[model samples]
Target: MFRLALKSLLNRRGTVLLTVFTIALSTALLVGVERVRSEARSSFASTLSGTDLIVGARAGTVQLLLYSVFRLGEPTANVSWATYQQIAAAPAVAWTVPISLGDSHRGYRVLGTTGAYFEHYRFGNRQPLAFAHGEPFAGVYEAVLGSEVAAKLGYSLGDDIVIAHGIGRVSFSNHDDKPFRIAGILAPTGTPVDRTVHVPLAAIEAIHLDWQSGTRLPGRGISAEQALTHDLTPRSITAFLVGLKSRVATFQLQRQINEYRGEALSAILPGVALQQLWSLTGVAENALRLVAACVVIVGILGMSTALLTTLNERRREMAILRSVGARPRTILGLLCLEAMSLTLAGIVLGVLLLYAILAAVRGYAASQFGLFLGLGLPTAAELYALAAIFSAGLVAGMVPAWLGYRRSLSDGLAVRT
Candidate 1:
């Protein structure tokens, strides 16, 4: 029966191939979308590492994180400098690195932070930032560029670049035109750090001495050199990354931040806050999966349609098999085998195609999106999804096979009327 099934399917290879390719495309899309989502979640989660808490003004925690770490959104309000000093001086705080955002050189974000950032901040599970060239920013105007910033802009040590006032694509305000001397360039970290340009908080204040909000002073202006003599004290910063001296002090500090008497500020554990943010965005994630699954389903439907249409052409073939003393069960097995075979072929082809795609794109995705997609073994969930697809294909084939078998019996020993 199996031999006959193989011979029969081979004879119908033209139609079978079309069906297989159809199912293959569907399976690949379903698997690919799901894998992308899972990996992206992991990538986003990796953005927050080793930091116990993030303290910022009383706005959305998600917004605070986006501006503080990801540089995607505007800060609702800046936390007071005095408040940050208090938070840093808290008994529970081990080290605090203040971040002043909303400036960018060309396209990369400018992070005005202290040297403690290079020492205490961590990414991707406590990995430290390493210098690719030169040292950390030592003076107010010295800058450290992330790997992306350096590579994209072709920046190197001792290079000078001017920053713009706002974070977006278009901003009218320019910094006091004092170019920042590139003190260092960092090795690629694959986190948001790889896209940032770091400078001292004093430099941030210095750039905006004559600016208000996001605009330049209009009539009041100072050359980058003239601004040097002025006291560039930062009135506020976007947020502060906090590491606790003891694990026990986390709850205490969160309580302190939430109940602070002077200012409306809040503190959040990075991991917990990330979890909450993901939950809020989970709907869109699942919708992506569903949309991919639907696309694959359409392909499977194409496979079914191809098989059903070809049944008419295979009528004589089935009649010949019955005449040759093949049992009804044998005929049924033949149809099922053909369906299963097509599905297997589709699956194998799709896997190869997916591999080729990933190989072609691994470097680009890593460089552009900071997402590292490994072509290693598929996760267990992925395997399950694949298995489900395989089984579904087999079943889809079985339906047409059964119909052919019935037609064979109903018209045994003769062509249909």
Candidate 2:
């Protein structure tokens, strides 16, 4: 039966190839989307699991996460260093890292914090920032660039760059006189950290010391040397990344921190905020999945339509099989086998195509977007899609198979489709 089916399909290679190609492209779409969804989900969960609470000015949970973790927006009001100190001094607080963000070099955000940031701030399940170049920056005028910033700005160890105040489309003030030398370059962390520049919190104050209202002290120029001697108090910090002393105290800490009287501040669990984000995005995700399923259905329908339409032309062929004492069931099996074979071929083609695309853009995607797709054999999602396709093919073929069987039954040697 299998040999007969193969020979029948081989004789109709042109039409069979088209049907298989259709199924293959649909399978690829289904598999590719699933891969992105899986990897993106894994990336989001692993990125911020270590932080117990992210403290910032009173804002929506998503807003706070956007500003603090992804650097998508600025805090409306910064928590004063005094407030940060109070939080750090709390018995419930295991450790704290102050973050002061405002400046930018080109497009990458510059973070002002202490060495404690590098020590405690984690990504992907408490994964520490690994260095690719020198150690952490110690001097006020030294900077550590993230992998993305280094690659984008063509910066390396010992390179100096000016900081610009305010993350605007354009800025008039530049800290050119007090340029910072790159002390280290961090390895690719696959998070927002990969695109940030890190310097001591004091450096943030140092650069803005001689300036007022986002410009140099006009008619009162203070040299970088003279500016160093003067008091540079940072009025506020963008936010602080906090870790709790005990895992059980998360709720207590969140409630305590949100009700703090010092400022309109709030603390949110990174994981919870991410869940909220996914919940919001779930509608669109489902819509996309539905569309993909429809595409697969259309492809299967196309295969069924092609086979059914050709029944009249192949009616003579069916008659010959019946004359050779091939049962009506044999003819049905042959038709069903063709559809299943087409679906399987399509699965193989689509997978091979995806691998080719991944190979072509592996470096570009990683360097430009920091998205690293791990190439391997079929994931469970791909396997599931393949199974679904084959099943759909079988169901689709059954209709035409039944039609062919009936025609063969009615006209054993004189067929009419």
Candidate 3:
């Protein structure tokens, strides 16, 4: 029966092949959406691990997280340097790394922070940042490049690079006088850290010394040497990352920071804030999944239509088989087997295509979008989706199977046109 089914499909290879390709495309779309969505969530969740609280000027927690951690947007307001110091001085606080934004180097964000950032910042299962080349920035005139920044710009240790005044890629107000030499190159962490340029907090201050209101002061230039002789203390920073002495003090310190009398502030637990961000994005994710599912349905319907059309052309073949002692049920089973074979072949082809595309674009996706896709075995959710698709295909085949049974009985002992 299986041999007969195989030959039957081979008889109409052209249509069968097209049907398989359509189904393959749909299967790929469905599985690909799930894979990318799952990996994106994992990447975001692991970006800021081991941090207890993120303190910043009063704003939405999600907004603060996106700007401070992911570098997606700008801060609504700056937190005073004094406020950051007070938060760091809290009895329950173990360490704090102040983040000063508002600078860019060739489209990548330049993050001005202290050495404590390398010592305390964690990601991806409490993993500490590691250097692939030199050491962390220790001097105000030096900088450390993230893996992506170094590779994309072809920068090496000791290469001098000028930072721009604002976050835009093209800035007319470039800090040309005080260019920073590359001090270190960090190893890739598959997080946003891989895209940042790290510099000492004082570097941020030194570059802005001769600027006012986001522009260089007219005819009043502070040379790099002269700027160093003056106070380089930062007046304000974008935000700060805080680690607690104990897990128990997290909530207490968070409450204290939120209610501080000196300034309007907000402290958020990193895990909670990350969850909120994911929930907010859930709507769009679901919509994508729905679209993929609809395409799969359309593909299945196309396969069904192909099968129904083939029944008319094969009526004479059905009559010959019945004359050769084939039962109605046997004819029905043969048609069903052909359907299953086509679906199974499509699934295999789709899976192979998916892995091929993943291998080709994995590195580009990580570099361009910070999305890391791995070529591992399908997750349980993916397996379930495949199984459900196979079941639906089987059910769809039953309709043609029933019609073939009735047609075999009616057309027996006579060759139909």
Candidate 4:
């Protein structure tokens, strides 16, 4: 019976192949959507691993998170250097990495932070930032380039690069006098860090020595060497990352920073803020899944239509089988088996197709969009989804199966008329 069913499908190979292709495309889409969502959440969550709290001037929690971690927007105000000192002095604080933004090199963001950022900041399972070449900046005029920044800008160690006075790519004023030499290039971390330029906090102050209230003072130009000779204390900073002495003090410290009287401040748990950000933007992910589901339905419907239409043309074949001692139940099973076979083939083909496409584009995706896609077996939920699709295929075949049974019964009872 199985051989007969296989031969029968081969006889209508054109329609069968089309149905298989449609179902395969649908399965690929379903699996692809689930993988993207899963990896996106993982990538985002891993970007700030092991950080206890993100402290910034008073602002919306999401806003603070966006500016501090993602480097999305400008801060409304900066926390005073005095306030930062107090936060770092708290007994519950294990360490603090102060960050100063607002400078740009070409189009990439320039981050002014202490060497502590390299030692304390981590991502992806407590993974410390690793250098691809050379070491951290040892002088105020030295800089380290992120992997993407180095690649895109074609920068190498010992190359002198000047930063612009503003954050935009089209800045009118450039800090031409205080060019920094590339000291290191960091390995890719698949996070925003991959797109940033790192320098010591003193470098930030050095570049602005002749400026006050967001503009350079007239006739007060100072050379980089002269600026370095002065006290380069940062009066304020954009935000800071905090590590706590213990997990139990996380909430306690967050509350303390929120009610801080020295300045208007806000402290957020990175994990909690990340969850809120996802919840706010999760509609897009859900929408993609919905579209994929609809495509799967369309594919199943095409398969059912092909089967139902084939039943009419195969009536004579059904009569011939009935004459050969085949029961009506046998005809029904044959139709069901054909449908199940097509669906199973499609699921397998789709999985193979997905992996092939991912392998081809994985490098491009990571470099272009910072999305790192892993090739692995389907997750348990994905396996369940495939099983549901198979079950749906069987149900789809029932209509044609029932018609074949009735056709067999009628062929057995028909007269010459």
Best by TM-score: 3
Per-residue CA lDDT of model 4 for 63-93, tens digit only, reads 9998998888889899999999998999999
lDDT of 1 by residue, 146-225 (tens): 99889988888898888888776566666737779999999888788988989999999888887886777788887778
What is the TM-score (0 to 1) of candidate 4?
0.93
lDDT of 1 at 377: 79
- Displacement of the residue 366 alpha carbon in candidate 3, Å: 1.6
Of candidates 3 and 2, the better by TM-score: 3
Off-target runs (Cα >4 Å) in candidate 3 are 408-417
lDDT string, candidate 3, 1-417, tens digits: 989999989989999999899888888888999999999999998898889999999999999999999999889899999888877998888899899888998889999999999999999999999999999887889999999999999999999999998888788889999999999999999999999999999989999998999999999999999999999999999999998899998888889889999999999998899889889999999999999999888878888889999887788788888888898999889988988998888888888888889999999999888999989999998888788778778778888888889884456556445
On the 0 to 100 scale, the lDDT of residue 174 in model 3 is 93
lDDT of each: 0.82, 0.83, 0.90, 0.90
Listed per candidate, the RMSD to the true structure in angstroms reads 2.1, 2.2, 1.2, 2.3
Off by over 4 Å in 2: 168-173, 367-369, 409-417
The Cα error of candidate 2 at residue 341, in Å, is 0.3
Sum up the clashes in candidate 1.
0
> What's the lDDT of the predicted structure labeled candidate 3?
0.90
Residue 41's lDDT within candidate 2 is: 70
Model 3, residue 273: distance off in Å is: 1.2
